[model samples]
Target: MSKFKYIVVALLLSACTSDDTDTLIENSNTLTNYLQDRSVENGAVIACAGNTEDDTVSVEIFFYPEEDATNYRLYETSSTDVDSNDFLNYNRIFLNDAPVFNGYLRKFTGEFTTERWFIVSFEKDNEIKLSNPIRLKNESQPTLFANAISINQQLSQMPLFNWNVNSEMNNAIFFQVLSTINNDLISGTYTYENQFQYYDTSNVILNITNGTPPDLVLGDDYKMTIMDVSVDNWINEIFVSQFTVE
Candidate 1:
């Protein structure tokens, strides 16, 4: 071949090879997955602030860039930093389809009926991103059995409401007092803390303040719901009954 033709053929081969190299570089898109947000709501609790027993649970998990994950699974365990191998002995469930900012919000259908941590398993980039555990506990059930609606001389005088705290409950628990009419909290509500089940089988008062009104309408029917919540939002058990303020 002529010298000019040989040079032209060599240039074409180099251009082809350069194109192949560019394609290879462009295809190297690997990412590490992480959890940007994780939360649990409306899980089964005996007493929530305004929740009922039959309420279903809502879960949320999100990551940046939005499309990195292809699978989201839920695992139940007593431990932390668990992986796929833990899924073997752990109670597991899959939230099928690609992931989105709003995660799978559904009922608690796992085999665990007592207490367990619900951990999110985000599968992306051929790796897993596990979330901080959202707990679900039923062992220490609190009861509002002692709080009864009273009609007396002083409406401003709140009752030292009675309750039962479970042994499995956290040392610090949240207590909510609601004055309700027709099953709705009327006027305002109050919340208090019960530490370490210290006051189990006893009563306490939610002191009404400016945030919560001290006035109660006389001759009007009202009910008091004493609800206790665990520290991790895992337990809520409410006791409710009707009484008129005379």
Candidate 2:
């Protein structure tokens, strides 16, 4: 996008999230200055999925970065909105300790709370690329596809996943994550429809950012989870299933 358009979007976002008039103006200026000289693109950060268990939560963040990208960084805040300038004050999260999948997805597990926000960035040739602010929401209800879907993993071919839903989705967006039994993310994407045959680009919204889909290890156990996120960003339902690649 043009630099002017990028700054305009940032200014509007800052205004919506800042309650104080002075803070809004300051945030607007910060965003304007930060994005002015940078190359900005939508979908740099595509999708985020979270799992909360009791008092703890695990979040999977996905991003597309340049092949030469280095010095990957994550910043955190307790506020509702975050901009590039906010990263200066936001606490940096060390990703060296997090599990990485396909060199694009990162997983972080920690105590659960209602007020945490995150943003991701990476440096390529000394220029930093930023991702949109992301936050995870708690699940609202069990998903209809809990035990209603069937997956066929054929050797040398993509897996075929089909499901049956008995209720209305209420216009929710579907997101799927394929992971190892130990919770290592393999591939993740969004689908607007109910059925997603693995690696079928036509049926998916945001295809995996990894250059190529990683092969699922035969005879090894794996997990598949599908979450429905509403327009408000809340997770309305989730389906988690485990299987052994036969």
Full-model lDDT for every candidate: 0.37, 0.54
Candidate 1: which pairs clash? 47-236, 47-237, 171-196
In terms of TM-score, how similar is model 2 to the real structure? 0.57
- Estimate the TM-score of every prediction: 0.38, 0.57
Candidate 2: pairs in clash:
none
**Model 2 misses residue 207 by how many Å?**
2.6
Model 1 stretches with alpha carbons more than 4 Å out: 1-115, 118-134, 139-171, 187-214
Error of 1 at 113 (Å): 4.0
What is the TM-score (0 to 1) of candidate 1? 0.38
